[model samples]
Target chain A: MPYMDKRNAARLVNDYADMIMRIGLMYLKQTYDAEDICQEVFIKLMSAELTFEDREHEKAWIIRTTINTCKDRKKLAFYRYWSGEPKEELVSGDDFTGNDLLEEIKKLAKWQRVAIYLYYYEEYSTAEIAMLTGRTKSSVQKDLSRGRKFLKNILESEYGKDYGFEKGGADYAE
Target chain B: MQNREKIKKAFSGVHFSEMEKSLMTDRISEASLFAKERTGKNNMKMKRWQRVAMIVAGVLVLGGTVGAAAGTDMIRSWSNSFSDFKTAGKISQKASELGMNSFPDEIAGFEYSGGNTVHNTGEDEAGNSTGDWDELEAEYKNEDGKSIYISQSPVVEGKDDQQHTDEVVIDGTTVLYDCDEYLFLPPDMEGKTDQKLLDREASDDHFFISYGSDEPETKFFKNASFVIGDIRYLIFSYDEVSEDELISVVRELIQK
Candidate 1:
């Protein structure tokens, strides 16, 4: 399929490189593996005959491919004994805030983190998150609720009452 | 603010550095060549006349900017800079209407720090500009050298607050994760001994981490936000500050 010209293809990669890498990092935690998966996703996009009805369709396709590629990489024998190594470059650059919360999110079960990241950070609907993670809508909703409760406790214990860490009205609908 | 909202803010404020972006570009270029080869082979299947007709169609589309969507998307990335606002000391009428809160100079333990101009406008879902949302910001630092910066303003619903969800409490309270916003140091932090030490520590190769984003949207610190009492507060912290710590700082300030 003559999906996009070379310039357009390059633009797609440039526009989405960070998004793919972020999702990969959220999943893998290991930077190298995430980067590799990011590259593979773009390469797959390059080869796939993807026709988009709109930008959302194109973005969904990329994200879905990235998640699938990351899952495949996780299945590798190397991943079984994978030591979550911290890359030196990322820490040194030392940008972004709320690192402790990010650490806590990383500590979560993979499906939960993926669901939470998509649901909260990416601003995807629970239905959309369910589609992305291959889970039921109710399951995604439950993960968000459970994940929120789990994180609230961790944050409360970690920061203590000096910060007023209380369960916020506790309505977990969205 | 709810814990879910804090989690959302914490995750969204992540910034990817320029170095990391460059690496991603390199990888994309490499992938593009391989993609070109495969697509080129596919092109060979088309008859010459068909190829010619497609080229003409593409040319016509390019004239109207439809075919250059990639190019348009690329430009849109860099052009998404924050808009500047004219400063006013008195509260706007809109603030009164929204019942926004006024913030104290000290939060947790950090003092007021200023760098970037206050922003009063946020983008709507349709990418339209919504007006009359004003902001006030201050930076606070404790004796331990850790600092927090905060921006307070009325909640601008559906205006770039996509991270907002029903995770909000019944009181219409929610927190926003500003992954796209950066925190600049106040004019006073420059040349301070402890601040320099923190900068050195940041670059000392303790742990190298980079987010692979095409957009160069990274700064040297971390930040989070929440809305309470009809006011939205944005907080940025440096030197290994926890999200809980940041929230606590905001809690202390807002409670006052």
Candidate 2:
């Protein structure tokens, strides 16, 4: 059992650290804050009295804790945006875009931009996306549909033909 | 296929580091040591036993302890130890609410006094009702006559508040316990009068102990709390101290 060896715990943190950071960044929208959340999650993992059954259990705990930490942070009063960052900054939406879709989706609202990235780039099922990003399934469905339409319209205007836009849309789908 | 190619191409340029990994081997090794320090080898072996054998053996063993204690007075050894009675109440209720039905024999180091943080007498768990200790904290002067603040960490689901589970004694005049941080204190002999006396007079024979830990993320050595007047005396943890340094400092406090 992983509990038999406590270091398995820290090693667990080191392994999923990146995925956890990215998922948190998608929701939090700040690189530094996402890093802070990642560190806090690991510290919690290290200090926890819990002894897990195995690697799988530890990974699940970290991911779940990451989501819960994000939720907790949302409840807290301060977003404390770092000074000098543009309010309209775009987080990487590489997931849902080729050069064609990427250029188009950047025009969407900030939250909608990520909603599309999560849908197409990360390839999360609607339910998985909802869980990771803390949205209701209906909200996720709506956001994805809205994001898709926005991408569609933007591409249509640029390409002038449905052909280029249709190909980009296929790439953006679940 | 084309979409897959595009996303992968974007992913490649997203600029993550050459995947630098932390050299956490030392941390793991240190954690292994801590785990061992807490649960002795025999305790670990017992934890591995399956249910039926575990229960029967546990009963037989506890029954043996009862017969031994029937003749020995375990209570008389230390009459002055104090434990945190309030924390047990909150944890006990929460466990019941979750149907975990556990009194959580421990929440890490804040076990019974003398057990975890405060080194309180073990009997508090056996006694009466108290308020929630989840938010309880009090200010006290450590051996150096310096101010110190201690309290249980807050509750967030899935996180251990890092509260030393070992009992702490709050008589309201002075706070006493064996918290890991109890070993921490401010720079020497400030705002303290009597504590200096204790450090001076108590040095020769009273109990002297040292506990230290280093944070791997940043190199820092933290010492365990000191005992002055039979309480966890807060002293600076990371600073190096000669054998006589703290003793002399605490001796001055004990004087007043």
Candidate 3:
């Protein structure tokens, strides 16, 4: 739902802006324009008259706007993602710091990454993830199950076996 | 533990912080407050003289004065009324009676009736009570909240710097309402709106606001809207006139 007051709106914005920015940055990976996309998404939320059906709906709207803004930025001429082809032939590879883990996760197929992240980062139920991302509950489950396995393999390949299963089940163990 | 909680622990760094949430909320609040400015961009507004004539006229009624001319003859009296007052005591006395705002007199123009005001006029004073303007045709003004039409001038709001920003102070201490939402753009927008936005009988000073196109096409809409100021204004392409004409119109609106 649209917040009626400034204090509430400010509180919501402050909480979500970083998440939105990271979402935009996750897609385009251009730090210069990441903040612009974040601001634009909020403006879109206001312009489109998006209202929260509930607190959960509001959260989902922000995520959706962030994703749309990322897609919009990709339409710009200068913005093209590296194919992981060859580094020397690329324009500028100033790899933004602190995103190595995120980059690895980006290798996952689009739906898998979206399903994986929304589940792990937002702590949403498979049903709730489906609602947020506009996918089917079963699809979220499939993606989540696959995502877990992919992450397990990533940890094993990056480190070793003990570290993979140890941290892996630990999140589920708790 | 629930499956959701388990997944959450696996990825713990993406929590939305309290401060970030606050900023989004603030933007939404501000955006909604004046969300209509962009839409009103296409609507034509009344002109400078019409608006100035209205506010200067509005002040007259507020000050307990009766009727006053709204022409070049009364310009000084309308803007810097105190400067023409020889007796500071009388000015202070009027202030007490009206409790007029304490804004600098230099910024506020005044119109006194040489000791004759509607407040000072006797109730029995008949017919000629409205000074010389009693014979002129009355027009409606947005004076006093609700719109009222009068042949005689009433106290109306005025903006001396109507056409351009260099003439208006960044803080705009003299403007009747706050001006943060008004993003004055450079010349170039000629017919984005209509020609009716050009001609107006609104105020002594006129302001022309231009709407910038969504630079990157993806941003299809703009959000700033006017809440504090007049809703009527002129919008035209800056190219219609030569450099000389732009400055001339701006100067006339600024009354400099």
Candidate of highest lDDT: 1
**Model 3 chain B: lowest-lDDT 10 consecutive positions:** B216-225
Q: Fraction of the real A/B interface contacts present in each candidate?
A: 0.25, 0.14, 0.28
Best by DockQ: 2
Candidate 2 structure quality by residue, lDDT tens digits, B181-243: 122122222234257544642342212211222221111222122333322333222233332
Candidate 2 interface RMSD (Å): 12.7
Model 1 error, position B16 (Å): 4.5
Candidate 2, residue B98: how far the Cα is off, in Å: 20
Error of 3 at B130 (Å): 36
DockQ (model 1, Cα): 0.10
**After superposition, candidate 3 runs with Cα above 4 Å error:** A1-5, A29-32, A75-100, A161-174, B1-256
> For residues A144-169, could you state the per-residue lDDT of candidate 2 as single tens digits?
66766665576557655442224336
Better of 1 and 3 by TM-score: 1
TM-score of chain B of each: 0.38, 0.23, 0.19
RMSD of each: 28.5, 15.7, 21.8
